[model samples]
Each structure stands twice: as C-alpha cells, then as structure tokens.
Target chain A: MLSFSEENYLKAIYHIEQLQTEGASTNTVAKKMQTKASSVTDMLQKLADKRLVVYKKYQGALLSAKGKKIAASVIRKHRLWETFLVNKLNFSWDEVHDIAEQLEHIKSEKLIDSLDAFLEFPRVDPHGDPIPDKDGNMTKQKKVMLSTLKENQQSKLVTIKDSSDNFLRYLDKKQIAIGNTIKVIAIEPFDKSIQVQIEGREFMITEEVAENLLVEIPSLTLPKVKRTN
Target chain B: MLSFSEENYLKAIYHIEQLQTEGASTNTVAKKMQTKASSVTDMLQKLADKRLVVYKKYQGALLSAKGKKIAASVIRKHRLWETFLVNKLNFSWDEVHDIAEQLEHIKSEKLIDSLDAFLEFPRVDPHGDPIPDKDGNMTKQKKVMLSTLKENQQSKLVTIKDSSDNFLRYLDKKQIAIGNTIKVIAIEPFDKSIQVQIEGREFMITEEVAENLLVEIPSLTLPKVKRTN
Candidate 1:
C-alpha cells in the first residue's frame, strides 16, 4: 500500500521508539537512518499528516497504531525470510540478515502467507526474534537479560536482541540456538562476567554479551535422569 | 528495475519475437497479454521509445537485443523463485507459478543472487524450463512434441511449452514430472489417442493432451536414483 522507502521510514521510526522509553528524537532517527535531519523532518511531517506517526517539530516521532502494524508486518516478512534462509537454504545465521533485509520489502501478502505455511509457521527467526502474526501481534515472551540471572541459577536461551552479523557468527560458533538450555554455574566477581553451561559444555560470557542475550527461567519439571538405565 | 507489468510486457514481446519468422503482430500480442489491442499499441510505443522494442505500426514489434537481455534477466528471476518455492517452500509444482510471477518483479540484485546460491544454482525450474545464467545466456534444448512421437518409441518428458497453472495441475494429477521415462505403446487410429507407459503404469492420452506435452526422443538420463546392493 505504501512505497518501499516510506515503509523503511516507518520501520526505522518504530525501532527507534522501541529502544527508547519515551518518544523517538529526530536526531536519533536521522542517525539510525543514516540520512540528513532535514530529510527526516520532511518525511516525518508527511507521516504525521498521514496519521501514521505523531510528530512535533525538533522532537522525534512515534508510530501510530496503523504505523506500528505496518512496521510489524515488515518485520514479520524479514524474520520469515531469515528463518527460510537458515533452515532451508543452508545459509549461516550471520549470512542471512542482509539478504532478508531486502526480501522483507517484497510486497505480496500471498507470498508471505504461503511462506509462513511452508516454513511450518515458525514463531521465531534464526536470531530468536519473534515472527509477528498476520494481525501484527508479536509472540510475547517473559524473557530477561542473561546478566539478570542469579548465580547458580539455570535458564534457557530464548532469543538475542542484536542483529549484528558478527554477533550471530559468534552464536553459531558457540553452538547456541533458540532452544538451548543454559546453566549459570558461577559469576566472576572481578568483571561481573559469568560462566554458563550449555549442552554439557561450559563457556564464559562477558557482561555485555550476557546483557544482549535473552533467557527464560525454566519451570519446575521432572528430575533429570542421572545414570540412565 | 521496472514495474512488474512492464517486465511482463518485455518478456511477452521477447517470446513472441522468438516464435515468428519475422516480427510479432500487435493483435497476437494483445491476445497473448489478454489486453485490448489499443492497450498493446500504447505500451508498444512506450517500449519502442525506451529502446526495448522495435515497433512499426501495421507490422509488429521485435525485442531489441537490450530488450531480450532484460527479458532473460526477468525469466532468470522467475525460474529461480519457482525453484525456491517448489524445492524449499514445499509448494507443489502446480502451486508455484503465481507466486513466482509476483516474486519475479522484486528489484533486488542481491536477493536474486542469494536465491541462486540458496537453490544451489539450479539449471532449471521444476517444470524443466531452463533458467538463464548470470549473464542472461539461456541453455538451448531441442524441443519435441509428444504428438510427434512414433508408436512404440520411447522418450523422456522434458519441458512443457505452456506453463499454465491448469496444465501443471493436470500433469500433477497424472503423476507426470520432468525426466520421467515414457513409451508410446499404442495409438488408436480412429481418434489418434495414444497409450503410454511410465514406470510400468499405462495411461491413455488424448490428442489434445499429447500436443501440449513436450518430450525428447530416446529420453535422457533418469533423474531417479537406483538402489545399489
């Protein structure tokens, strides 16, 4: 319904809004979009007139409900393409983001629906980002920063917030995935880094890395089978 | 690089030019595009000015070499998307054409490149239509109509000249696919209908169906794998 460039603006604005507690600023948006402040201002005014964004001069913009819906739809396409690339095309998680970025702009509802069906309606992409539903509802989860976990507490890696290719490559090298279980074995007092266990193997994670990693506390379940029959 | 409608027009003109000994007529193009002759005339003038078509009123239009290159590029994108849909997306052979038709219009060189890599550089789509290479060079194949096959002679299913969804669905229901070995066991003299055997299963084929089905004499190597003891 909208131009690709306009959709990109909305998606960028939406992401800026998500990162901040309040409204997004014009400077921040310009920085995020790698465009001049004047251009962003011009587009923001247009979006405000369209009721897709709430904008005030010198201040940033927040997406209206309709704007948020469009952003989420674009994100849904992005994540679905990423999942398809990783799962079916044998592309490394790190290698898929740029390609999926372009594919997300392909404007066909039927293509996305068939893709969602073909990918078995995956809830998340390779990066653990939720794939939005058809109605633009995100797959909400009660996840916390890995750094927030207490010492000796165990959890599972559910998602990662960073989309940097280097970070994804690191995850691939670590053999960590969406469903991987992680145990918080110890905390290093000097640097606030932690030692965690995954798949019976242990690795040390820095505070910065842990903060970017999303984790879910496991519910109580049947005891582990030690010394199996 | 162009609108989907424009790319489709270029492809139509390219194919039409390939068919005729000389140039392609406007009426024929109008019929092929399912549009009014007036619309065809309008588009032809536009394409001619763009240097993509050589048009002369009351005669016909021929694709310029540049036009053919653009058409081949579009065909490359179309077949690549088809392979991706059918092979990776689990779309049936009958279900991919429409989706590919839309996907072919996405104007991202990187997306197509990634898709080509994703599909392992398939030489053809599921329908056995040759996918043009990176430089827009299409692999040529000898065409043979099923109606031309002699009784008791064997051949292999190759490409279908007509790729209509209805035709593909019919083939799917009959368990027909590219590279399947077939032998014309008998032909009824009265109506010119033939009986063909595939994988030891015999099927009666009507004259109309035979004319639509394309094959190659003596067949080619079987695509199926033989078990080894």
Candidate 2:
C-alpha cells in the first residue's frame, strides 16, 4: 500500500546504488532527483522507518532487501511497458520513457504478470537493457563503453547508458541501433573521438557519443598502435 | 494538468449529473466519495476556482464544459485500458477494474491513442458501457432496467448499472452476459421479483438483481398482466 511517491523514492535509491555500488548518499539522491538535500534526508528517514532502507551515518541510505525487491519490480514493469509501447503500440524509443515512468507505479502484480505474458516475456526493453524477472532477478550481461574498444577491436552494441529522448533521437538520426557490429578502425588522439565502421558503413562518432554506447567486446584485449592526429 | 483526485471528482460530478439530471448536491457528493461534507465543500470550492465546476447555492456542483471534457477523457482512458486488460491480457471482467483505475490516470494522448488503435478501436468496454471517443463524444444508446420490462416481454441486455466484482461474479454464475435476449416470463406480485428466460435457460432473479441489469426493449412497451403467486 505504498504511495506512488514512496515507490519512486525507493526506485531512485536503488538506481543510485546500482550505478555507484556503494549505496546512495543523501546528497547524491537529491542530485539525481533534482531536489534539496534536506528533503532527501527526510525521505531517507521515512523509508528507514518503514524498513525499506537503512540509513548509515557516513554512507548515507542503503536499500534493504525489501526495498530492492520493490525497486526491481517497478523496473520490471517499466521495461515491459516500454516494450509494449514500442513493439505493440508503434511508439518510437524516445517517446516511451516518460510514459513508462508513470506506468511503473501502477500497483497490481497480476496486471504486470498478465502484461508480461501478453508481450510473450520480452528479454530486454527497446533500449537493450535487460528486464528483471518477477523475483527481482536480473540477467546480467556485462558491457563496456564503446570508446574503450581498441583499434581493430570489434564489439556488438548491447545497451545505451543514456536513454534520454535526445540521445535516442541522435541514435535514430545516425542509424545506430542495438545488436549492430561496431569495429573501431581509427582513434583520433587529438580529441579522443573514434572512427568506426558499422555494418560496413564508415563513420566518426564524438567521444561523448562513444562513451554512452555500451558494447560487449571480444575476449582478447589488444590495444595496439593505431592512433591518428 | 489536473491531479488524479481532481479528475476523479470531476467524473463523479459528471456521473451524478447524468443520473439525477439536476447536477450533484454537496451532501450527495460527500456520500458518494465517502468523505466529510466539509471536505467535499472544500474540494467543490477548489474545483470552482479552477473553473471546472460551478457550485450552485443550495443546489450542488455542476461540471463546466472544460471539466466535462476532462472527465470524459479520463473515462475514455479507463474504459480503453479495461478493454485492453480483458481482451488482450486475458484478465477476467471482475479483475480489471482496480488496475484500470490506476492506468486511467496515465497522461499521454499519444499512448492512449496508440492503445486505442491497438485494441482495434473498441466500441465499448468489457462491461458493455460505451467508450467515449477521442473528442469526448459518446454514441447515445438508451437503456432501461430489466425490472421495468413488462411480463413476457423480451429485451437485449446492454449494460449493468452495478459493475462491482460481486455483481459480475453473480452474472458469471448465472451465465448471463451482454447482448443476451432476456424474456421476462413471470413476475412475483409479492416481492416484485422477476423470472426470466435467458438463452433458453429459465431462472429466477431477485428484484435487486433485476434492477441492476439494464437492457433495451424492441419497439412499443405493452404492459401485460401476468403476475404469479
């Protein structure tokens, strides 16, 4: 019977913990939520009182197992809904996030489970992020930034770290999509930009863009000499 | 953008006006909402300030044009989501209401429109209530209570005035459904209970049940005298 606001706060803390792996500090939660630090502290105390989170004096707020379960469930619902909007409703990737954000708060395990069955159990969302299972279990597939690829190193685009509409729109304009084969052909040492070939098409992507594109590299790491001016 | 509570109040007011045809009184609204009369008064004033409702002295609250539009839109979303839940997700009629209640508050015209298209532009919800169009227009289909039908008269079941899960379960148990041809074979003079033949199956229903089942009669109503002991 948690309020939507409380669920959102739990989800934010879970995401922050995932990214940092050291749990979320009050200041970091505030920054991520675009709110005041004092307000985040108040929320953290409330969640702690509910046994959803544990507040450490120095380390800030950490999600309890109960909190993690709820967070993962929300994420699961969000990804499933995004998949529905894109695959079933014909919505583009850029337009699904905010709507899914609102939809994730809809309570009812039966509804979400039914939706999961309707979508035939999607493995990943349109953004290529793996969806969590009903028990808060995630199928982990490790990915590294595309810029980390060595010259002549080939990798498969797995996910996008930044799922902003602007980023999705940029990817749409550039024809960069998940499951594409990206091979680094050259590296511009002057600006750290990477020149790559995708599906036999040559292109140069900015360093920022490359950093946002997460990819799975081949087993061998050979950082050979292949830098240009 | 109206809050979900505000949208719900507008919808309540709209329904009250539809049923009474004289708009809603503050007391009736409070009773319907299960809140205090004073709280309802505060909400009415707030709605009046927003120009969504016009509060009449000694009367009640009436929806403005804009308010009616919003209420209809919310209802449209609710009915559409209920259709999706039952039709696509394999949810039973009794199981879809609460989930659809939360989903109706989702704010995305494109999402709802896309869903409408996905559901193949449903004419009515699973409960047989007509779904409002994108512009808040509904096709008028007049219906009267089954209890009002004359003896031996036949009518097509259209909608149920009471859509509670218990009522739906009752209908399911009796195998009664929308579009079924119901013939009032006999009437009890003592309690006013009616015995109807549905799909060649003869069954006796309580007066309260007859009052909740709404239907459309053929042409002219001929009240015949066929009362039983």
Each prediction's TM-score versus the true structure: 0.65, 0.96
The candidate maximizing DockQ is 2
User: Could you give candidate 1's per-residue lDDT for residues B1-229 as a string of tens digits?
Assistant: 5676779999888777766657778898899899999999999898899999899888778988888899999999999998987887677887778777767887767668878987889998999988998789987777788888877778888888777788888888888889988788889999999999987899898888888878875545434445697
Q: After TM-score superposition, what is the CA distance of residue A179 in candidate 1 from its true location, in Å?
A: 13
**Candidate 2 residue-wise lDDT, A126-154, digit = tens:** 99999999999998888999998878889
Candidate 1, residues A1-229, lDDT tens digits: the string is 6877789899888787766657778888888888998899999999999999999887778899999999999999999988987887677778787777778888778779988998899998887778899999986677888888876677888888885877877887888777788887889989999999988999898998889888885554633546667
Model 1 residue B160 lDDT? 83
* Each model's iRMS: 3.2, 0.5
Please give the CA lDDT of all the candidate structures: 0.84, 0.91
Instruction: Supply candidate 1's per-residue lDDT for B148.
Output: 84
Interface RMS for model 1: 3.2
Off by over 4 Å in 1: A1-71, A85-102, A105-128, A139-229, B218-229
